[model samples]
Target: MGSSSLRVYGGVAGNDRKAERRAQLIEAGLELLGTGDGEQGVTVRGVCKRSGLTARYFYESFADRDELAVAVFDHVVSGIATATLEAVDSAPAGTRAKVRAGLATIVRTVAEDPRRGRLLFSPALSSTVLAHRRVESTRMFARLLGGQVREHYGIGGSTALDLMTEFLVGGLAQALTSWLNGVLDLSEEGLVEHCLEMFLAVQGGRLEPGDGAAGLQAGTG
Candidate 1:
């Protein structure tokens, strides 16, 4: 069928229908994978059952259970990362402002949808495909952070910046995991504030190519 004729079903296009089904499967995967049940929760049959779709529809979106799980993880991570970037872009200038803006967006995004939090850090992720994806995500965040830090510092290439970014990314991930697990003993606001401080503190350090953010302070973002 041509593209225009694909919209015959209640005015919804075939591609749109497929996208909806794909989203449904991903959301179902999120529910299963983010639960305390972990990796085992993301079977194809389980996803089909959870999404209230047939096996045929499930295969239409994902090649396998692992693919769906990976898609769910990527979706959540992409959501938070994209929101954080937008928040930072709209925020007022200054090191603290940018940091606070980004941090607050991340915390709020996951808080608004707790599933994203659990999906990213649930204990159920032990020694699974999700674990590997988590590591890869950390690297992506590190690159983003490192680039932003260098831009703020007006600095050039330096391995120390890379190291610092990795530390921040890994530390933040662990800290967020603790927070989500109820071991951090802090409210979402408190978590964001604390993390903002830490990020600014690190940004304040003197790297090889540029000076520290010596005069930055906590304020409106």
Candidate 2:
């Protein structure tokens, strides 16, 4: 290779290293947030200490705590979104499989790491980060609905899509938050079944007797 090619390759490698370090810092911050009482949350100093990087490095990657919060929130949510999309994309060509695949990702991702799920679904961050957190999730649900609605339901419209997408995002958020708060008793499998049953009900479809219940598991002291 020419000297110019070598220089370009070297620069690319350095950039990747920098990006990896930045991601590490962000992940460290997220980890700290998951620890402790969660009242203080994760501060810039705390993150720098946890990351073993200087405050200067944290600034080099993020402007402030809120900015870092956004980055951490994005990092976590995007991982879940990617997994959900892949599950939905590869599901068998049927409404049942597709819906199960999408909702299953939600429940599994939350249950996979209860701490991370709490952080992601908690009101522990700024309002801005909280608001933007579900944008990707909502978009994923919309895409998931786009294919299934047309194929199995034989229904298609911007309005219907918007409603179903809202239902999925809002419902999942509420379900996870409730479970985190001890209001809902939902196992990984149970949550997936309940969510799909609720979706069908909201879409004006009836639940079969053996499928699942739209009601919450009762009694919490």
Candidate 3:
């Protein structure tokens, strides 16, 4: 079947069905990414097979594997971002508490499926793929952290916020990589607790022993 017969999601007549199918394909791609090694996670063929949809459907919504990968990346990032925001935004009572909540949400979500976590942060993906994703992911991180910092601590307007956001994202990315590789032996709760500790220390809310986040604020600010 051609792209015409394959249907475009959310575009026009018969679009709802196509949109639903597209959502399923993206979901299937994420699941495949979960089960496979981080290295082989979610190829186009794998997504088609897992989604039980025709390859034509894939091309109908995506120009190529890299395009499909970008779609999947966006979908997954949106989910994680939503959950993380919710976790952080709910009445945390203080800046430190909210920051801890935010860190907890991030580490727990990534720890749940490390392969997808790795894929989200992989810099080696195609430039076209990486460009679209970097913008989306960076914006998501920036929006959440910027809002939280301003609301909880009176920080404003993309100065320290940018540095802090980069620190949080880069730190979490490295932590996820280490955990997935078995170098970091931390349970979800332990991950959340330890990560929050370092995050707070680095955020300048505390100065304690073993806080790898020391000097992070000065460097970023």
Worst-scoring 10-residue span by lDDT in model 3: 207-216
Tell me the TM-score of each prediction against the true structure. 0.87, 0.75, 0.74
For model 3, how does the per-residue alpha-carbon lDDT over 1-221 read when each residue is reduced to its tens digit? 64457555456646667787799887786676555554246577888898999888887787876666677788778888888889877845766677677777777777677656756755444356556776668777876776666555543454555777778766876787677667888887887788877777656654233333333344544
Cα lDDT tens digits, model 1, 1-221, are 67456664888779899899999999888888766477776688888999999999998888988888789999999988888888888999877788899999888888788788888877767657788998899999999887777676776646666777898888888898898888899999999999988986776643323465332222212
lDDT for predicted candidate 2 compared with the true structure? 0.69
Model 3 residue 19 CA deviation (Å) reads: 1.4
**lDDT, candidate 2, 117-193, per-residue tens:** 76666666436565675566567657766555654544444554566567767777888888877888767788789
lDDT over C-alpha atoms for residue 76 of model 1: 90
List runs of model 2 lying over 4 Å from the truth: 1-12, 37-40, 126-156, 205-221
In lDDT terms, which candidate is top? Answer: 1
RMSD, candidate 1, Å:
5.3
- lDDT (Cα, 0-100) at 30 in candidate 1: 84
Model 3 misplacement above 4 A: 1-13, 37-44, 122-128, 131-136, 206-221
